[model samples]
Each structure stands twice: as C-alpha cells, then as structure tokens.
Target: MKDLFDEIDTHQPERQPIGEGAVLLRGYALQLGKDLLPSLHDIGAAAPFRHMVTPGGFEMSVAMTNCGQAGWITDRAGYRYDSHDPVSGKLWPPMPDAFLDLATGAAREAGYPEFSPDACLINRYEPGARLSLHQDKNERDFANPIVSVSLGLPATFQFGGLKRTDPVRKFALRHGDVVVWGGPSRLCYHGVPTLKHGSHPQLGSVRFNLTFRKAL
Candidate 1:
C-alpha cells in the first residue's frame, strides 16, 4: 500500500522538458507501479469500460478501454482506430506485456526509439471527467510518440499549442506520470482538466489514463 517506489525514491523525478519532441518522464511509471496496476486490471477484464458516443452526439465523460493492435473509438462515425470491441464484438484486449513494456519503455525514455505501441487509450477519470484541448489526429503516424500513463486520481494536464489559441501548460499529472508527446510536439493541443475531488491509495476516486498510440 505504501511502496510505489517509496515516494519515487524520495524525490528526483525531473525530466520535464515540455515541447519540441516533448518530455515529462517524471516518476516514469513509478517502478512500473507493481506491474502497471495488475496489467490494467487485466485489460479491464477484457475490454469492459464504456462511455463513448461523441460525434457531436456528446456523451463521453471519460470511461474508455483498449490494449494493442488498435482500440480508441467513438460513435456517429468518427474518431477511428478499432480492432473490434464495439462493445464486446471482441478482439480488442491483448496488449499487456505490461502494456508492451510500459509503452516501449516510455518511448525510450521520451526520446522515442523503438516505441512500438499499436494503440492503448484506456482513459477513465471520475470527479467530473473532462478532456478538451484535443489534436491526437487519429494516429496512423504523426511520426510517433504519445506515451501518456499517469495512473490514479491527480489530473490537470492541458499542454496546448500549435493552434487552438495556443499558450497552455498546466501539467500536474501524478501517480507514475509519463507523458511523451513527439517531434514538433506531435500536433500538440493536449487536454484533461476537470477532475478534482481526490482519494487515491491505489486508485480510489479514480483517474487512470494510459494513452500510448501508434495506431495503425
């Protein structure tokens, strides 16, 4: 209950960069947080998180699901990347080699080396969930690099820029924090803001992000 790398080796997480091929490796999954929270609860017991709907139909308060070889989805014909699991159509839960070696070792420690992610998604905030800035551009290659990975509670990311009114920079993600971004910040405009009310002794009030893309 208390050894998530003991306060991350008693301070010294700093990697933080921010743009141009981004960075933020802080705590880098805190020693793999006991193997990435039981392989993300066994890939959510085989893809079972929901809240999707949004091609203007509007419904997504952040509950999602996924693994590898594709995942991120949405409805009304939009937001792609799907290898099935349009709700148990199956085939969407297999990427857990500790989530492909913690997203290929956090995209080679934020420098993007052999990062072979296929897609991971898996968000799941709670206290008034919210993710707005945008610009992931539905994968298929933005030159790769988008590792994300915080685990429970604590949010506030919003790294904006490259348009949409630019100038953002919130940060604060906690639990294992990873964030990678990509060359030219890979289309920048990040998000995740409205999640407050806490409690996380191991994911209590909830907040489990993950992201990791390379979606083909």
Candidate 2:
C-alpha cells in the first residue's frame, strides 16, 4: 500500500490554521452536511459499527466502524490490524474522496508536510460513552498525523502530552470542527471526556468522529 502522502503531497496549500505543531480547521464540513451523513451510512452498510472489547476484557465505551485499507481493533488478543473485517470476513469499507480530502487537508495544516492516510477509523459516541486517555501507538507509521473530525453533538476533546500523566488541554468541539495533531505531538495522549446527554437536531443524540491514519 502506498502512503496517501504519495498522492496528496504536492496538493498541500497554506490554507489551514496552524498552531505549534497542531492545526485546527473549523467549519470545514458545514457545506457538506447534506452529503456527509449519507456517505457515512454507506460506509456503515459496508463495515457496520460494533463495540469492541479491550485487552483487559472491558468493553470499550465507544462504538466503532471503519473505512479505507485498515481499521483499528483491540481485543483479548491485543491490538493489531487485519485486512478482513472480523465481523463480516470481508474487506473493510472504502474511504470516500470527501473523507480523504478532509484528512489530507487537515494533516497538512498540522505540519505533517506530506500527509497520506490509508485507514479511517469512524467512532460513534452516544450519551455516556467516553474513551480513556491513550496514545495512538499501533499504527504502522508515526510520521503521519491523526486527523480527527467531529460531527453531531458537541464533545470535550482532551489533548495531553506524551506521558499519560501529563496535564491535558480540553477543547469543546462542536459539529463540523476538525483537529489535527502530529510531529512531536503525534503520540501525545488524548481522549474524549464523558459525553453529555443531549440531542442534535441533525444527528439525534449520537456524536460521530472520523479519525484518519496511515495503517497498512
């Protein structure tokens, strides 16, 4: 598998917001609301969301699905990548151009310079769902930044440093917000705070996230 950077490198333009090594691009998807949900539904139809059990035998609070060449998985067997979806024995869903474009743009904005992603992990957070602080360390490469986009109800994003005990900067993310962090901050700890019970007129009570990565 070729890095998405191979195809998206020369297209990076200085159009996104940059901060230190991270970048925050806001309202980048508001114009595509009509298309985004349906596209996500198509992806779900292909790779359906399911709650995964962690190595510790605890069910992960978040519901997840995937699109692209690989999907992140955790279980008693530990974290790893597989081309076939365990639930369906079929190839995982394909990442749409919209997802790819968004990820590439956000990553470049985050100073990755040349960003290309092969896996897009789509996570769904309903009321009460929360992910504990953790580092993204299972990917085949750390040179790529993780591009995360939010949709639906607002969520509190916790961005911490390289250490698990590091203090975190919490940000309130509403629908259509995109956050990209890489470089020295790529392995920094991060997670969503407990989701508040609420309903978004557009997406009901569910919050959706698209996390772009380069996994093979």
Candidate 3:
C-alpha cells in the first residue's frame, strides 16, 4: 500500500475547485518548499508548538503555533486572535517574508488578490491527530479568503458545507498543496481526519499545515 501511495504521490499537481468559491492548488508550494522548511524551523523555535486547551477545557491533540501581527490561541478565554503568546506573554514572532509572499501568491492564483494576512496558524500533526469539522469564524473579516498550505505527510481534508451535518467531500492533500476558500464559502465547515502513520522523503513522521487569515 505504501508503494502504491508513493507511486501515486509522484503525479503532477493540478488546480481543483471543491466548491463555488473554494479551490485547491496542488503542489503550489513545491517551488518554494525548501525555503519554507528553514523558515518554519526558525519560527517554531521562537514560538514552539504546543497543544492548547479549548474553552471547554479539552486539550487539543494537534499542536499549534503562529506568526504575524496576531496569532490564534485558545484557553479559558476562548478561541481568538492575540498579539501575544499566552505562554511566553510576549509578542508572537513576526511572519516571515517568505510565508507572506507564498500566501499572497497562492491566494492571488485562487482568484483572491491583494490578500494581506495578519495571522498565520501553524499546525503540527502526528499519527492519530485529528480535527473535527468546524468553521473559521474567529476572524474579524470574512471577505478575505483563507489560504492553507500543506506539507510533509499526506492527509485527508474534509470540506463540508455551512451546517455541521452537511455532507463532506474528502480530498487527498499532499505536500506542497494549497487550499483556498472564501467569499460565499468562507464560512464553510472543514477539518482534517486522523493522520495515518507514514514517512515522507522530506518530512518524517509529521505533517505541517500553514493557514493564513486576515485577523484583526
């Protein structure tokens, strides 16, 4: 099965539109993958990834961190964007130029131009880590698109409708793939299924996701 997946992983990237205003730019980050790694390393070092507890006091299995003017965080206060990391009580690391550029370019390619993201949430998932279906409503504006970049191990992304019970469409997201959704589909529910154990040539035993949003 690994061999089969590996074989299929070599296929060329393509643009896939999943809904009225959502599109997937497969392998869109391949050209800049090398630059992303070191940038992530530095950012992670400054703002190490850690599992956060929800408002209900449930710990999230997926570890996360952030960069840019504001960073997404959750605790007793609830899920919201903050300029400071609650852990260190200091300002979050500034978003790397490379990250900003990649996000802007990807958003522009997906029909959303002039996107200036103020918050970037970086998620790290290991085997068994999963995210339930939810909408991104914490941001101040819904007009700007959400640009998400996938890297490392491949995973299944669940893109659902406005309601929680809406039927979902799963997409195999490989390293370097970028998913962008906004406008009419901005409030759609989406999530990541449990990650299967596997190793990629570049990243071993882990998957990194970068989601850019215009958070105030």
lDDT by residue for model 2 (49-103), tens: 9999998999998999888888888889999877778999998888888887777
- Native-vs-model 3 lDDT? 0.90
Sort every candidate by TM-score, greatest first: 3, 2, 1
lDDT (Cα, 0-100) at 52 in candidate 2: 97
Q: How far in Å is the alpha carbon of 173 misplaced in model 1?
A: 18
Of the candidates numbered 1 and 2, which has the greater lDDT value?
1
90-173: candidate 3 lDDT, tens digit per residue: 899999988998899999999999799998999999999999999999999899999999988999999999999999999999
Ranking by lDDT: 3, 1, 2
Model 2: pairs clashing at backbone N, Cα or C within 3 Å: 4-116, 5-116
Model 2: residues with Cα > 4 Å off, grouped in runs:
1-19, 31-34
Off by over 4 Å in 3: 1-13
lDDT of 1 by residue, 1-216 (tens): 664445554565668888888988777777664667777788898888889999889998889998887888999899898798887788887787777787888788778887798878888889998988989988877888888888778888989888989799888978888889888989989898799988888668998888888888
Point to the candidate with the largest TM-score: 3
Candidate 2 contains a number of clashing pairs equal to 2
lDDT score, candidate 1, position 26? 76
Point out the higher-scoring one by TM-score: 1 or 2: 2
